[model samples]
Each structure stands twice: as structure tokens, then as C-alpha cells.
Target chain A: MKQDGLTIPGLLVASLVGLILVAALLDGRGAHATPGEERLFLPDAKYLKPMLIGFHGVAADLLWIRTVQYVGTHVETDRKFPQLAKALNLATSLDPHFLEPYRFGGLYLLYLARQPQAAVSLLEKGAAANPGRWELPHDLGRYYYLEAHDYARSREWWERAATLPGRPDYLPRFVARLYAETDHRETALELWSEIYRTAQNDSVRSLALQEIERLKAGSSEGPLGL
Target chain B: MTVAAIALNTFREAVRDRILYAILIFALVMLAGSTILVTISVGGEVKIIKDLGLACISIFGTLIAIFLGIGLVSKEIERRTLYTIITKPIHRYQFILGKYLGLVLTLLVNVAVMALGLLGLAYLWEGVSSVRLFLAVLFIFLELMLVTALALLFSAFSSPTLSAIFTLSLFVAGHLSGDLRLFAARFGGAVTKLSAETLYFLLPNLSRLNFKDQAVHGFGVDGGSMGLSFLYAIFHIAALVLAAMAIFERRDFK
Candidate 1:
């Protein structure tokens, strides 16, 4: 009746119950994951945007990291990301000027996830917000060329990028190829030839040569497989 | 001369606070922890590091200012030294000003330490330490000065707990004033809109002092904006400090 501590038996029982509860929670979480649970139920950026007291850049960076992890998680298990666009949208809305999410995240949607329209929209959003920067525009041009195969739109984006400061020197060549009304096969060959010319490593140079030789042989396929 | 003496003494006392060291250690750890977080990110490693680092400095520096600043007056009163000090040759306004200055000095040293840590991390990650980051820190310092003044104003007449609540609330409100104005203008009714607009203009508008985005991206911050932020902070701090002095002037210390 006095102030004696809990006996070893009591602690052991408590620990057993605690471990079982944790296991139950884990099991429930895994079993009950619907589309709603895919993104961990984080609210839209509009609701959470004002609460941070103007730490939008930091918020955007953290959200972008989460987006990458979300993509990675889907890549491993089901390869079905129902909330990929939502995740990307949340990060971009928090910081419209953040280009990495727009750039690499767009590539993920296009090449990896095969969601072409989402990729184009995201890249266009980035380009619209950051017209002064060429990365988004350049990536847009590449996406249109590789996946969409819309030469006119691709050339327009490439020209915009080429005019912007800090664009890669090869961007003008891409624009030129588009302007000459060359077909996708010839343009693809020229692109690889340029890569072969400027290859810094033996492996990259070899890859470029293979791509170029494949194109030159008039294979019906395109470069940079989707 | 007397204010300077009080300010130096206050600075010495504030430096010994254990809470300051705790906050400083947490900030340094976060700055270093960002490196670990960057390993998984596919791009913007340098930008992520810089953004997190600057956010750490701003958030922690404001905590330091508010936490230390709130106690500047109450601690002396609690220690029963206020009576002894006020009876001396210094006026109450000078006392308030000196206390504010001392905390500002403390924030300067703390912010500079955190700034150097952030710049060092950014350099290690990116191979180039941008001097423009300091421009962000400069604006953060101005924000801290305004927060300190708010804390001092509340501490002049209220308990430390209430003072912290008031100061922190105003700090958040100041940052959100712009958004509040937008929401009010777009959605609110006639009277509600008018009141929100008035409060928005009357508040400190701390978001104006935010330059972290400019630092992370580029030097989009021009000279005109910096000058405007500085002038805004000066006016707000002056008004808050004067209010604190008036409250202290009429404070009836039993």
C-alpha cells in the first residue's frame, strides 16, 4: 500500500501491450491506404501557405523533397502515383520560383510516369513564372521534341530559351534544326551528333555514337526513349 | 554615457542565459542536418541548404530576440533590482532604450554566428559562398530589432508570459498582414474590409523585411526596397520603444 514502484511483471505486461498496439497501428495503416492516404493527407498548399509566416521558400524545398520521396515510394512498390500531380502542385504553389521541381519533376512525369500533359503543364508553369531563367524553357523544348513531337511548339520554346541569358550554347543549334524543317529522324541524328562531338567521357561518347549510328541506319524509332 | 553603461551591463547578463545557448545549439544542428536531408534530393542541393539555413537563422534569431527581450524588464523586476536602478540618475526612457539596445547587440552576435555557419555550409555544399546571403541576414536582423521592440513594449507593463504571447502574436500578425489585406479586399464585407485594411496598414508588416527568397534565387532585391524596409523598421521600432518608455514612465512599482 506504500510507495513501492511497479513490479517487473507490470512493466512487462505494459510493454507487451504497447508493442501490440504499435503493430496494430502499422498493420492498419498499410491495409487502409486508399488514394486519399497516398499523400499522407497533407492539405492543399492554399490552406497551409499563410500559416508559415512567410517561410515559403523553405516550405517549398521541404515539399519538393517530399514529392521526390513520394515518387520514389511509388516507383518501388506499385509504380502508381495517384497524387503525383497534387504533390508537385503543392510544392510549386508554395514557391512558384522554385525551378527544380518544375524541371526534374516534369521529367519524372514525362519519361518515368508517362504523364505527358502534366509534364507540359508543370514546365509551362515554371516558364511562366521564371521567364528570365532559361532552364525551364529549355526543358520544355526538349520535352516537346522528345515526347510530344510538336516541332513548331518545340522550336518556339527553344528560341525563347536561346534568347534568354545563361542558356547552353547548343540551344541555338536545336532551334536551327527545328527552323530548317528537318524531320524528327534527321533532327534526332544531329542532336546525337552534337552530343557525340561534346562528350566529356568515353561512356557518354559511346552512347552518343550508338544513338547516332542507330538513327543513321534509318530505324523507325526515336532517340531518348519514353 | 549612462545608457551605454546600462546597455553593456544588460548585454553581459543576457549572454549568460542558458536558453540562448540551447537555441544556438539547435540552430547549428539544423544547419548541419540540412546536409543529410540534401542527400536524397535530386536537385537544388545548394538552394535547399541556403533556404533551410536562412530560415533557421530567421526563426531562431526571432526566438532569441523575443525570449530574451521579454525578460529584459521582468527579470530585473523579479530580482528586485528595478527599484534600485530606477532610483539612480538614469531616466526610465533611457532605461528602456538601453535594455532594447543591449538585446539588439546580443541578437547581432547571435545572428552573425548563425550567418557564418550557414555561409560555411553553403560553401561546402556549393563550392562558392555567396555574399548575397548576408543581404538576407541583414533584413532578418532588421526584423529581429522590430520584434525586440515589441517584446520590450509588452514587458514594460505586463508579466513575461503575457508579454511573450503579445509579442509573438504581433510578430505573426505582422507577417500575415499582406495576406490579410488581400483576403479582406477580395472577400470581406464593407466594414470588415475597412477594419482589416486599416489593421494591415497599421501593423508592422514584417513580411516586408523578408529577403530570404532573394538570397536563395538571386539579388532580385534592389536598393529601393532595402531602403524602404529599413525606414519602415525604424519608424516601427521608434514608436514601440517610445510606447514602452511611456508605459514604464507611469508604471507604479509597489
Candidate 2:
């Protein structure tokens, strides 16, 4: 009887330790994996809205964070952001007043994803949804000026951005310069250089470098390049 | 005096429930996990933490309210404890009110603990305490009280299983009532519009009681609206509790 009691206790302890080790190994495997590889499929915002049960803002916040992770993971390997725009779209749709996803998502779509048209559409939606905010219109203007090379649209957006409250001081100056149409190549070079200097990732830096090089070669080719 | 005694006893009973502690522990764990969640967000880390933390408290707190509230009367009846209580020198309405108060009190304690954990986490993140976050939590507590009243109303008339289902349906419907109103205005034709409008007015407008968006964004919530929401919650809760009392008074004990 004494030996049997000791045997039971020993078996219980061994099983407990064995279970903990297995759990730790599983946890370590999950922790070591890249966050991007674990993509979450979110349902449509219309269907999701009612199910959120008044936690829509919290859901939006989580989706926005997931979009950031998607960008961080894909920006390195595939240089493809298939889900980034969709995630941002869903997040903003759930909470239309959320401003960050529109601004930053627009930048990522434009520069890294090379979806300039989609970027413009997203920024336009953001501008309409958030009329009082200056950042959306300001970003729209920047995309037009730098990427699309559509000076007329850029000037129009910049003028609108300038009229809004909290716009940076440089916006009005850019609007004026765009209207004057003076030193276009120099301005493009300066914008690309700034983006290159402030870029947080290798993809953005390389894109900026390519733009700078293109601008430099064009400038060397004189007014015909402009 | 009798009602107070029953209320206190019910509160003690609720405190000892293992499910309450289980939900409370899960809520606290999720609130603590907000710290890890914030590290992944590029900007608005503080907002993410506060938003998720408040959501965890509200969601888990509602589950506790519904689960416990539904069992308040039925569990007593099932254990033959209701006979002893009804045979006492107490009215059935008093018993119902006592049960409701006890659950509300229990919810108050749990929500306060969760709120403090969230606020402590928020302070650690941004180094400042937010009055708006607290106000949001207060409204969430009121919402939970309303849900508890709902559970009690169903419990007085039905089985605990059915009561849980009814309370949860109402919770979903209450939150969606605003959208229902909008749908009526936009798409419904004559009879459907009238029916939708009538249901909208009859149902609880939970969206009015939700201050999470205003709290997270630091937007100024108008004082008049806040007062109106508080009054709405009070009137709705009172109506539900009175209805429960009326049903309990007519319920067959034999």
C-alpha cells in the first residue's frame, strides 16, 4: 500500500511535467513564426458590424494593427501587399472616422504596392468621409504631385488641403509653387530625397532611391526630360 | 429589511460562484494582454490598449450578468429554496427586486476591478489617467445593469436555458435597433416602415449608451445627451424590473 501511494504521486508529477513541456514547445513554435504568415480572414464589414455588439471601434483598431503587420511581413519577401489594402478598407469601413489607416495605407499602396489608382481612390474616400481633417487631402495632393505627375490635380488638392485647419505650413507654399510651375524637376528631386531619408523600410528606401535616380537623369537631360 | 437581507444573501451567493471568477480572470488576462497587443500597432498604441481593454470588460461583464441573472430565481426554485423564501414574511416583488439588486451589486464590483486594471494599464502606456475612459466604463456598467434586468425578466417567466437565449437575443437587438430605424427610413414602405419605427421605439437603443467611440477619440460628448442616456437606462431598467416583479407575483409555485 505504501509503495502504491508513492507510485501514484510519482506518475502524477511526471505527467504534469510532461504536459507542461509539450505546451511550452508548442508556444515556442508559434512565437518563432513570422506574424505575416498567419493571416486572418475578416468577414464583410456590413455583416461584421452588427455582430461586433457595440465593440466596432475595438474591432477596427485590431484590424488596423493586423494591416500593419501584413505590410511589415510582406514588404520584405514578396514585396506584394495583396491583403493590406483590403484590410485597411475593412478597418476604415467599420469605423469611418479612423484616420490613420487611410493616410498610411494610402502611402503604402502608392509607394510600395505600386497601386497608385487604388491609393487615390482610398484617399478620396477618406477625404470625403473626413472633410474637416487636412491630412487625407494633403496626402491625396502629394500622391498626385509625386507619383501621377498630374500637376493640375495636385494643385487642386493642395489648394483644398491648404484651406483646411491644421495643414502644414509647407502645403500653401507647395500650392503656390505648383501654380507658378517653376523648377519642377528640382521640386520632384527634393520630395523623393525627403521620402528616401525618412523611409522606415528597405522597400520604401529603394523606391525612393529609384525615383531620385530617375529625377537626376531627367534633370541632366534638360527641359526635354522635364 | 427583508428585501435588504435577501439582496445581501444573494450577493454572497453570487460571489461564491466559480463561473464569476472564471470570467473575471479571463477579462483580467485579456486586459493584461493588451500590453502585448499594443507593441504591434504602429501608432495609436494607447488608443488600442484602452479600446480593447474596455471592450473585454464590457463583453465579459455582460456574459456574467446574463449567466448569473438568469439563474437567480430558477436556481432557488430548483433547489427548493424558493419555498422557504416565499413562505417568509416577504412579497414576491421584494424577492425579485432583491435578486436584481444583488446581481447589479456583483456586476458593480467586477466592473470596478476590471476598470481599475484597464486604467492601470492605460496609465502605464500613456502616463495619464483618462476621465473619459472612466465615464465610458460607467455607461458600460449601466448597460450591464440593463442586461441583468433583461435576464431577470426572462427568468421570472421561463427556464434558465430559455432565459439566457432571450436575454442574449435582446442584447443583440438592442444594439442593432438604431440601424433598424435607419433601414426603415431609407427602404421600408408604409406598413413595414411603421412596424420598424414602432419596434425601434420599443427596443432599447444600446448605441445611445455606448460612449466607446467618443472616449477612444477624446471627442466631447454633449452633457445633454449623456443625461438623456442615463435617464433612458434608468427608465428601461425600472420598466424591466417591474415587469419581472409582476410576472413573479403571478407565478405558480405548486
Q: Which candidate wins on DockQ? A: 2
Q: Please report, in order, the local distance difference test score of every candidate based on alpha carbons.
A: 0.85, 0.87
Stretches of model 2 off by over 4 angstroms after superposition:
A1-42, A179-226, B182-195
Each prediction's DockQ against the real complex: 0.46, 0.51
User: Once model 1 is optimally superposed onto the true structure by TM-score, how far is the C-alpha of residue A184 displaced, in angstroms?
Assistant: 3.9
Docking class of 2: medium
lDDT tens per residue, model 1, B1-254: 88898899989999999999999999999999999998877778888999999999989998999899999999999999999998898899899989999999999999999999998888887788786788889989999999999999999988999999999999999988999899998999999999998998788999899888888987566889889888998999999999999999999997
Cα DockQ of the candidate 1 complex = 0.46
Model 1 chain A, poorest ten-residue lDDT window? A198-207
Give the lDDT of residue B224 in candidate 1: 90
Clashes of 2: 0
Give the number of the best model, judged by lDDT: 2
True contacts kept of each: 0.66, 0.69
Pairs of colliding residues, candidate 1: none
Report the lDDT tens digits of candidate 2 across residue range A28-110: 99877865566668789999988787889888998988888788877766777777777888998888878878877887887
Which lDDT tens digits does candidate 1 get at residues A1-226? 3334557668889999999999999998888775325654457788888898889888889888888888777765777767777778778988898888987787678655768889889989889989899988887887677657788988999899999999888788778878887667766776667657854435446756876787778775554454
